[model samples]
Target: MIEIVRTSDLVLLGFLQSLLENANIPFFVADLHMSALEGMIGAFPRRVLVPADHVTQARRLIDEAGLKAELLS
Candidate 1:
């Protein structure tokens, strides 16, 4: 899997994931527990992932939504 975005905000992640799902794109979320863990630390970070082949399309959908994509290094 390839990560397309990373953030601590589950709300924003939910919104973005909904957008991708609505577009019929497949995605997997990782570090979900991190959100809760980070909340205690004052930051909840999660990740959105997809098959390597879908990475480009996923990234495109995110970008087209006018949301900045936090590409994983």
Candidate 2:
């Protein structure tokens, strides 16, 4: 699967997951547990993954929500 996007923060990652799920876009998250732990123990950015097929639409939806994806129209 293509790595469309990456991010840290389980909360935000969860939000992204929910967004994708709600949009009917299939996805998978990687390094979630590891990253969350890292963020807690090391305070580093966590990372999440998404399928390449859903990248564009997922990004668009995220941008539309303005949750974390802040993109200009």
Candidate 3:
């Protein structure tokens, strides 16, 4: 998997997940369970990842959603 975006914004994370789901793109939210360890302080940002083959499409989708700034270069 390739990391596409890392964010502490739960709302944006949910929106991105939904966007990927609607487009039939498989994704995984890494470190999603870390909040328990970090006391839910948003200290550990979640990572959005996709298969190597899906990186381009996933990035394009995120970019179109006006989240280009969130994408990893």
lDDT of 3: 0.97
Question: Could you tell me the C-alpha RMSD of candidate 3 in Å?
Answer: 0.5
Error of 3 at 23 (Å): 0.4
Stretches of candidate 2 off by over 4 Å are 35-39, 42-44, 67-73
Model 1: lDDT to the true structure: 0.77
Local accuracy of candidate 3 as per-residue lDDT tens digits, 1-73? 9999999999999999999999999999999999999999999999999999999999999999999999999
Quote the lDDT for 17 in model 2: 75
For model 2, the run of ten residues with the poorest summed lDDT: 41-50
Q: Residue 46 error for model 1, in Å?
A: 0.6
What's the distance in Å from true for residue 58, model 2?
1.0
Instruction: Give the alpha-carbon lDDT of every model.
Output: 0.77, 0.63, 0.97
> Could you say which candidate leads in TM-score?
3
How far does residue 10 in candidate 2 sit from its true spot (Å)? 2.2
Best by lDDT: 3
lDDT of 3 at 50: 100
After TM-score superposition, the amount by which residue 53's alpha carbon in candidate 2 deviates from its true location, in angstroms, is 2.2
Put down candidate 1 lDDT per residue, 41-67, tens digits, no spaces: 636567788998887887777777777
Clashes of 3: 0
